[model samples]
Target: MKAVVIGGGIAGLLAARVLTESFDDVVVLERDKLSDEPEYRAGVPQGRHVHGLLVRGGEIMEGLFPGLRDELVRSGAHLMDAGEMRILNPLGWVASGRSGMPLLVVSRPLLETHIRRRVTAKIVDDAHVTGLTFRGSTVDGVLTRDGRIDADLVVDASGRSSKLPAWLAEAGIAVPEPEVVDSRTGYATRLYTAPPEIPVVVAESLSAPDTPRGGIVMRIEGDRVMVTAQGAGGDHPPRDPEGFQQFLDSLRGPIAGMLADAEPVTPVYLFARTASRRIAFEQVTGWPGGLVAIGDAVCVFNPVYGQGMTVAAMAALLFRRHSDFSAKGCRDFQRKVAKTAQGSWVLSSNADQSWAGVEKTPAPLMRAFRWYMKKWQVALVHDQDIFLRFLRVVHLVASPATLMNPVVFRRLAKYSRLDPRPGRRRAARSPR
Candidate 1:
């Protein structure tokens, strides 16, 4: 069997790697030229920004490509326990300790380079896929600039700019409109020489209404730290250095102070396409066979939550588990991929809805859930157990439902009475 995967990004590379197990031959088609070194390319504009390989994502990638974690660490990626990182949420700072969940802090380019090296598949760079080749109702191959490449299965792992919907529409397959919840979030990132005593990840969480700005200082590969200033609801960070520093200073944490004397190594790069979008291809009654879409081709989350890579990894894993090349099999796999993205979509969209300029209002149940989450955030400040659960959920290791367990529910009930004021003040430091 032959599988053709479009886009040689993290999603495409991982999908190609997984397809190698099921298909006799797997080929990846990338529009941009693949570089030997970890250099930024035009295809991935967000490659210059900060990216995190969450604990669950790290585990999945390591399982797919063995020794991946150690290799990343050797290549200058920081491997640290997630809890050791200092996190300044809207409520207060989360206690620093060992949570037993390991995180790999690496840049997009370096991580993609290492994964591309490990993928045992034929990757054809500059093979721009324009459309799909159909054998009657089933998609048999892809139409590229060079020629038609036949495949038993075609996987669309393209990023946010995927043209699968348009291609499908041309083939008479009507797809549903994608669900979107955009908070107008924007990011400004610059690489700085790491100070001697900087934390692995120092982040100030963005809350809605009052605090629309946030920032993070993450230690990545090459002895450098990436400082990203983020804003939502039209309060975007500026591209200029002076304006960026002022925005950082406006954040609730010590991010600005930590980078007071640090020397910048790169110019500030701005990324503003941070909307939560999901297309329900599985819901299409006339969905074609021998084709599947994963990663940003299906759903995209707010970058502030850092869920894109991990969710892409999860979708690839789902693809591997449901590896059947038949018509019904492709439809089933797409459905599973949609299911995988649903949780992250809800989490990201719910948070975005809390912002001021967001048009969508939360339903009654979601409003209640958000209310409970606010209380849960307060509990995270004083309760380590609750914080660990929250960490697991955020890492995609556990379901969000786990946060409503009796233990967490009782804690929320207990902390519900505490003042839920928004600011930098550490509300009720006592562990009562």
Candidate 2:
């Protein structure tokens, strides 16, 4: 069987890698010129921002590619435990001990390039995909500007700017409306030389209700730390250095102190589109078979949550599990992938909605969950076991349902009464 994967980013590479196991031939179509080295491009605008392979994301990639993490480490990416990182969350400072999630701190382009090298699919960069070729209702292949490439299976791993809706509509198929939950958050990132004594990653969650902002400083390869300062509702992070410092100073913790006198390596890069979008592809009437959409093409979460790459890996896992290529099979895969994304969707949606000016109404269940989680975050500060479990959920290593256990709830209730605010340790503790 032949398979064609559109948008040769991480999602497409991983999908092609998996498809190579079953298909006789696989073609990866990319719009940008894929580079051998880690660098910039027009296709992945958000790739310039800081990215981390959340525990499960790294594990999923490792399972699929085998030794990819080691390659990243050898090539300069850092594979450290999340415990070594310092996090200042909304409730308070979380005490770090065991790094439960196998975290990989690396730039997006480097990761993409490494994965691209491993996948056996023939990648056609600079190939602009126009639409799909349909045989009755099944997608027989993809139609690019140059010519048509026939395939038995078509996987749309294109990022958020996917042409799926337009193609589906052009083919006389019903296009699914995207469900958008946006906080209108924006952030600016600048690269600086790694500080003398900085943790591999520092996630300072300015989760306070009045001034909800976020900041992250991650040590990537090439002895540099990428810092991202974010704000919501048009409250964007500044692009200038002096103003960027001001944004850093306003955080719950003063990362400015750590960045004190650090040499700037790159100018600030701004990314403002922080909306959570999901397409109900499964619910689309007369949905065609032999085609499936993955990655940001199907669902786009707030980048602050860092679930984008992880969820993409999870989608690859989903494809591997239900290895069916027929129309009914592909349609079933699309719906199942959405079902898998529900937990991750809720995790980020709850966080982004915590800020003001976010107009989306929370579901009754999410409303109740947020109410309980407010205390849970506070409890997380004082309790290590709860913190670990919560981290597991955030990392996609465990189910969100685990947090609802009666025993866990009882503990949270006890902590809730004792410490209403939850994060007991607000002061920054230098990494051990």
lDDT for each residue of candidate 1 in 77-172, tens digit (9 for 90 to 100): 888899777777777877556789989999999999999999999999988899999987789999988889999999999889999999999998
User: lDDT of each structure?
Assistant: 0.86, 0.83
Best by lDDT: 1
Clashing pairs in 2: 289-327, 378-422
**Candidate 1: stretches off by over 4 Å:** 424-432
**lDDT score, candidate 2, position 326:** 74
TM-scores vs. true structure, each candidate = 0.97, 0.95
lDDT of 2 by residue, 201-290 (tens): 878765535546768888888988888998876678889989988888877675778788678888989888779999988888888878
The prediction achieving the highest TM-score against the true structure is: 1
Give the range where candidate 1 is weakest over 10 consecutive residues by summed lDDT: 423-432
| Candidate 2 minimal-lDDT segment of 10 residues | 422-431
